[model samples]
Target: MQRYFVPKEQFDESGVRITGEDARHIRRVMRMNVADTIICANNKGDAFLCKIKAFEDQSVIAGIESVLTSESELPVRITIAQGIPKGDKFDTIVQKGTECGAAAFIPFHSERTVSVWQKEKSEKKRLRLQRIAKEASEQTHRLLIPEVEPLMTLDQLLIFSERFTCKAVAYEETAKAGVQSGLPSLLRNMKAGNSLIMVIGPEGGLSPNEAERLKQSGFLLCGLGPRILRTETAALYLLSCASYHFELLQREVDR
Candidate 1:
């Protein structure tokens, strides 16, 4: 069955109203007609098996045959503060991060970050990234579309640390300290329902001063592994590790 996203306000006891572009997609793109069965998610974590009841001039009405809660979100909320990389890396980050179950994404301008975010260009890029996140969320069957915040400087991100319960930053130098000192351990130690903030640096990775500053500000410094990953690669690595550590493997451990 085809799947589509429906707004929360459009859902009720009667049915869901699919209109505008979505209606066009159903009527034209997907070519779904009246009496056709499809799935619709309201972004509030509710999935409904819907059957097309009426097709109006500009809208389509679908009767909810059944509803189920979306269970794809990670147990712990993870917010990734990634150092904006050059080229199409940011788009890839947004798409993959959403699929990996990141609750939110922040593009940071770290000391070693090569990409500069001017106001107009930054907005343009953020919008594009935001669209990618939305599409990825829908494709992955995620209830919430992780937000991509505007670009922030290193200082700004450090100051924003008060927003999360647990904060971790990926530092390559820290791996040499010990094996338990990696991202997997940090995520493993996180309790359910905890909100986490992970910081990933740019191409060259976090500078010594930046790492020191983060440590001084109460951020837990963790390593990925012995092999150093690129700026774009680091966020996905941490996200996948986080999902496995907090959502899958951890749950089995608890059982």
Candidate 2:
């Protein structure tokens, strides 16, 4: 069934009320009508199998058939702290990262970051990314949409990361130095439900001084592998490894 994310307030004992573009998409694009079933998620980690009940004044009301209980999220909450890359690269990151089970994203201004955000346009750009994350979450059947947090400076990012259970920075220099144990070692210590923040630098990567500051702030410095990756690719790669360790390997361990 097609999935739509509705605000928690839109849900009630009877049904979910969906409005705006989603209502139009249901009535026009999907050609859905009363009695047709679809999946509705209340971004608070609850989902329902709903049957279309009524369409009124630009809204589609779907009666809840049953609650959905399957899980699609990663075992650990992973937040991608990306140094704001140039162009539309961040869009690709949010979309693919949501599919890969990232829980949230934080775009940061690093010493090597090239793109500068216009003060007036920053909110607009963030809203756009938020929309992309929502659509991607629904498409992937994610229990909740990954949040696209406000853009922050490197200092602000490090401070914000203080609350996470684990923190790491992906430094290409470490890869070049042939240090491969950091990430795996970190994952070995990770437990289910812990939150992790993985920082990936922009185009030129984090400056040596910036990497040092991160390490001083308790962020582990890790390498993706021997080959260096573009700023955008590093987050996806980290998420892939996390899924492999927490989801794939955990199943084998369980068996």
Candidate 3:
């Protein structure tokens, strides 16, 4: 069944009303008619199996059939703080990162960052990324859409790291030095429901001064592996590892 995320106000005791782009998607794109079943999720991450009740005034009213209970999120909340890269790489990062269970994304400007987000274009770019995250979340059956934050400075990102239970920076120098246990050790100590922030630099990578600042701020400088990864690959790699450790591994242990 197709899934649509509706605002909390649109949902009543019995059903949900999807409007605007989603209604158009259901009416014109999906061609859903009355009685067609679809999944509707509210802002609070509650999902319901709903049957289309009516189409009225550019809206699709769906009656709740049943509540859905399934775990589609990772045990740990992982936020990706990436230095702005060139071109559409950030879009791909958000799309794939959502599928891999990233809780949020923070795009920041580091010393080596080449792509700058001017004030005029920030909102437009953020909106595009938000759309990508929503589509990816629905496709992946995620209960909540990953948040895409406005671009921040390196100092702001460091300050934001204080809110996370654990923090790490993907440093190529660490990989070159064959330091591989930092990430695994961090993961082992992390408990369920903890929040993590993983930082990745842009194409030119982080400057030495920035790395030192992050380390001073209590961000672990970890290696993804012995190989160096691109800015886009680093975030996905961390998310995949997190999912395997927190989701797939835990499932096997439970079984």
The model with the greatest lDDT is 2
Rank by lDDT, descending? 2, 3, 1
Go through the candidates in order and give the C-alpha RMSD of each one to the true structure.
Answer: 2.0, 1.0, 1.0
TM-score of each: 0.91, 0.97, 0.97
Clashing pairs in 1: none
Q: Superpose all Cα atoms of candidate 1 onto the true structure and report the RMSD in Å to 1 decimal.
A: 2.0
Which sections of candidate 3 miss by over 4 Å? none
Q: lDDT of all the models against the reference?
A: 0.83, 0.91, 0.90
Flag the better candidate by lDDT, 1 or 3: 3
CA lDDT for candidate 2: 0.91
User: How does candidate 3 score on lDDT?
Assistant: 0.90
Better candidate number, 1 or 2, judged by TM-score: 2
Prediction 3 TM-score vs. true: 0.97
lDDT of 3 by residue, 105-189 (tens): 9999888888899989998999999999999999999899999988899888878889999998889998878777477788888
